[model samples]
Target: MAKKGDMLYAWTNDAEIKKHAELGGAVTGLWKFALESKAVDAVLVITKGTDLYDAQPVLISDPKELAKTAGSLHCGTLLMPKLIKNYFDGAANMKIGVTVKGCDAMAFYELAKRKQINLDNIIMIGVNCGGSVSPVRARKMITEKFGVDPDTVHKEEIDKGQFIIEYEGGHKGISMDELEEAGYGRRTNCRRCKMKVPRQADLACGNWGVIGDKAGKATFVEVCSEKGANLLEGAVKKGIIATEPANPKGLEIRGKVEGAMLKLGEKWRKKDFEGLGEGKDRLKKIMTETSRCIKCYSCILACPICYCVDCTTKNPAYVKPGELPPSFMFHLIRYAHIADSCVNCGQCEELCPAEIPNALFMHAQQVELEKMFGHVPGVNMELPLMAYVEEKQERARLKNTGSDMIYENVFNPVLKN
Candidate 1:
């Protein structure tokens, strides 16, 4: 049986699953095993909607429906952690096996830090992510860059430094460098993301470096915790999946590939932030850009860190209600509350109605905060510089001392996903 930190090449024993799965069916097999063995009450995954660009999250309890959820969806932009918090009680009441990208995994830790979710009951199976594309931009790229009908494209992937697609009668690939040069690749936040692999999850799996006979038919999985070890060893014992030690050469290749991606991320971070100018110039740009906000609250809602049910912005004491282009205070509330912990998930920018680069501004602030305080937001359970404190402490402060200070700002009780 594999132990935590073990890296293996794994594949499904089920042929039917193999037919529909990508790289390998091991992830799908794991989900099936988890459900059938009562290890988890349900599995959460993404399913295709109308076309390759239409990705939606589905919660499944029946193992029979697991096959359709196999494979990656690079066009998918949904944040999985928030869905669990909003719809599934943060997996607090029920055990769940859910696939997660780096951002999703990090968000879970951040939420757990705030006591919004029960991390002990949730099983996170992380996937290595190069990045994700916006749906609208994806469709346009397929039509114009790939020279094919977007609807005809049935599958897509980022592989060997290229964005590839398989259409009805043909398949084509274009270098990511080329696409991004033309301003049509991954989102700005994704371009600068450094979380290529989520070691914080129970198990981190991807098709990064499976080689030789198993090249296209296996997943490279790194067991990250005791929970992952137990789950993987259980699946193998049950004959639901098979495994072999990872190839040393493949491991070397994987390191190089990951290093290249990291360097690229650094390159993009420099370009994106430097273009905004330094210090005061950058803050000026952010304020000027956010001035157009129609008080939609979309950014606040989309953020994974804004966990207060009675939002501080609506306190009416800090930010007056019914104010158009709400005061700079609206933006300040977000900056103060979320800047130290922003995960750079890109949801705010994606959902913004006014086209503000909210992720860019927030991430820039997070970077600056990281430099000042040496606090990396979501890599672990470590509390931020602005600590997350339980709410009962706040109530006791008011009751015993009769002080109505109301908030420490940083210690607000958070809802975990």
Candidate 2:
């Protein structure tokens, strides 16, 4: 993960990159950094695609480059990890700087542990997330509600009080009161996502007071790791990100949902591993659910990992030309092959037309694997179960007692205990 002249660059958003790096300040309580800080040689800012909320990752080695690309924008987690990997792979020997949302950082962590990329030399910057919307859905919502083409709407903005939709004709603002009463605006993923502390990050940054408080104008930033702390100390010494601990009000603004996610994560974390359906019966359940799969292979394309040269589904092996649903065996075999390594990211479920909870099935399979083989798939930095040579005892663990295969491995009349 390290090499000569490598600088890990990261960004919170376009506004953060330009305003903070250029003025020697920090944005939204993110750590402040002076362009002169040697601890961070460069910065990479991500920007919202022109006319789109989805931001494409951008790398900046020079302060000038940082200023140019940074500006007002939104961050979308869906494409962030893919963008990070794309940039990291191209950098190769040189260390790169980058920023990621909570889920993106988790995905990166999972990938890094698997040795997909060496991230030790990379700098990680993290941002607190409120989640984001799909462009298609957002546009459709605006068009239906506001009676205007969403793309023609001059601007759309979100603030503590309301969601403001500004059009060429006029602007309409939806108050937080209304949004709450109407049960609108928040993304579904946020309801399920539990990571809030940025506990896995090096630095956590944000603008705590500025959103609702006009008088005070400091960003709320916390150093979550030694590397982040050292960088912040350097910035503070140089008067770049100068501040004291923020008021406790920001936490209140985050309110019940953040607390709910934290509670859910804690609750799930404490559950006994044995309670996760990690038995042969559990494995059978997974196989049964997968049997409903119609060889759609949509899951393969949805997966970030199944990056094969040519998938078997497309080859002459199983699929015939113009087949209706391919074959059920294709999906069943794929589940068996990839379930051990699956991270349960839920992409397959998200993309499934049948609304099958493929991720849940994979999660159950992973639980079974963890119980029997002592493997947890993508989370561990150590080698995967499939990577290891199976000991005689280990192989015997899979066979049912009284079965022929079990008898072959375990039975000896002279040695029976």
Candidate 3:
């Protein structure tokens, strides 16, 4: 039987699934097993859209339809938790199996904390993410940088610091660094993201470890919790998949990969934040950037953490309906409400018609709060700093308290600040 904290190399035993899946099809096999064995009522997945560049989230109840969601799409940028909470009745009624990237997993944790989702009825399968490309940007990159027709591309993969693409005749690969230098690559928020592995999820699966002959043919799976272990053991017992202990070298390699990605992320963070200047300069930069906003509310709609049914943004006193470039209060209200919970998913910035760097500013605010209160959002079930200090006395104490004093007085100081 699978055990919590067990790390193994696994693959789908089914030939068709192995052939169609990105890496050994272990994820697809597990989803199929969950549905056929009644472990879950439905599987939520992203399927290929009109073309290889498009991806659409779908809910599949039939095992036969699982194949359509086998492969990965780097251009698929939707966050699944909001859909589960807002559209699927918070998944309170049906058991579900869903795939998650780092952001999606964090969003799930935040939603669970707010009682928006029934975590008892959900199975989270975490996937490793380097980053995702915007569809429009990806098309342009292919056409100009790769000198290939974007429509002719059939497949894409990001590996070893390169963006690889495959078409009918052959394939081409470009250095991701080169692309970013040319003003094209992963989303800005993604480049600064440090969470490459979604360890918070039940099962963390990826191809980061396998090497040599097994390099592209197997998946490295980390059973993170009891629920994840049960799913793996059950699938194995039912002959849905095969597993073996992961190679020590594989695990070491995976650590090195994660370390390298984090280092690069740190570099990007410094570069991106440096432009904001400091003190009054930073405030001026923020004001200048947000002044372009046309009050489309696209950022609010795209945010996974925004759950208020009757939002203050809709109220005339706060944001004034039908006003163009609505007052700075509009953006300030959003920052204050979500700064503690923002997961840096980039949806807000990506969806903004004004092209404001919503995620960047929010993330900057979150970093400051993290320093002041030592609270990192979406990592666990803990309530945000604002949640605990709703009372006027608590707010007054917090305002007057020094960072070190706050760290020593209220919460665990041993935690990262």
Candidate 4:
């Protein structure tokens, strides 16, 4: 039987699944098995809506419908965790199997810590993420940079430091560095994200290190939990999938690849944060940028860290309604409440109407908070010790009823009990 910490090169036993799925179909095979065996009530997946750029999330109830969710839609930048929280009763009522990127996995934990999600009922299968390009930006990059119509593109891959696309006639690739330098690569938040592999999930699957003959023909899966080990062993025993021990060489290579990604993340973080500057300088930049906010609450509604039925931002005691651009308090409230727990999912900035660097500012503060308080969000199930006592109870209460006023002691936080 498979066990936690085992790394295996895995692929599907089914010919059709093998033919269609990217990198051996291990992830798709696991989801299909879960659905067919009733291991999960549904598998939440992203599928094409209109074109390659139009990635929509769907809840697949039947194993037969799994084919539509097969393959990769790297352009589909949607987060799966919030959908579970908002639509599926936070997976509290039904067992859910989901494929998550680093951000989605991180968000899941954050929501779970906030008591917005019931994690025991959900199976999280994490995929390694380099980053994702915005659908619109991807289309534009294809047309203007790749010199091809977006519709004609059959597949897109970010491999070997290049953004490669297979079109109707032929495939073309351009160095990601070239594209990013020219301002047309991954989302700004993605560039700075260091969560390359979400070991927080039960299984962390990726095509990063299936070397030798298995290269490009299998997924490298690291069994991260007993749940993952059980699922993998079951699939192998049932002939739903096949697996072999991962190569030691492949493991070494994977480590190097992850190191490179982390270094890149730090580089971007330094650049982004340095530009924002210190204290009053950063505050001034934030205030100036937020002055354009129409207070549409797109960022608030979309932020995975935010899950209040009655939002404090809308509380009239703090924020005066009908004020154009709102007040600095509006933005401060968000920074105060979210900065401690922000997973930097990029949803806030992605959905912002004013194109504010919302994630950048939030992440910048999160780093500062991490240094000062030693609380890192979404890395584990542990409640942040800084807020683990009476504050956690009050925060949990405020999530539903909300305070008529912001808590006064938010700044002078008590040490964890």
The list of candidate 2 runs beyond 4 A from truth reads: 1-44, 68-77, 84-87, 90-92, 154-164, 169-188, 207-216, 249-257, 261-302, 305-324, 333-417
Clashing residue pairs in candidate 1 are 116-415, 116-416, 117-416
Estimate the TM-score of every prediction. 0.95, 0.63, 0.92, 0.93
List, residue by residue over 266-337, the lDDT tens digit for candidate 1: 999999989899878877888899999998988887788988755779877688899988898999899998
Give the clash count for each candidate: 3, 18, 0, 0
lDDT of 4 at 333: 84
lDDT of 4: 0.88
Model 3 C-alpha RMSD vs. true structure (Å) is 7.6
Candidate 4 lDDT over 98-211, as tens digits, reads 999999998999888878789998899999999999998999999999899999997899998999999999999999889998999999899999999999999999998889
Ranking by lDDT: 1, 4, 3, 2
Stretches of model 4 off by over 4 angstroms after superposition: 385-417
Better of 1 and 3 by TM-score: 1
* Candidate scoring better on TM-score of 2 and 4: 4
Best-performing candidate as measured by lDDT: 1
Native-to-model Cα distance after best TM-score fit, residue 85 in candidate 1, in Å: 1.3
lDDT to native, each model: 0.89, 0.52, 0.87, 0.88
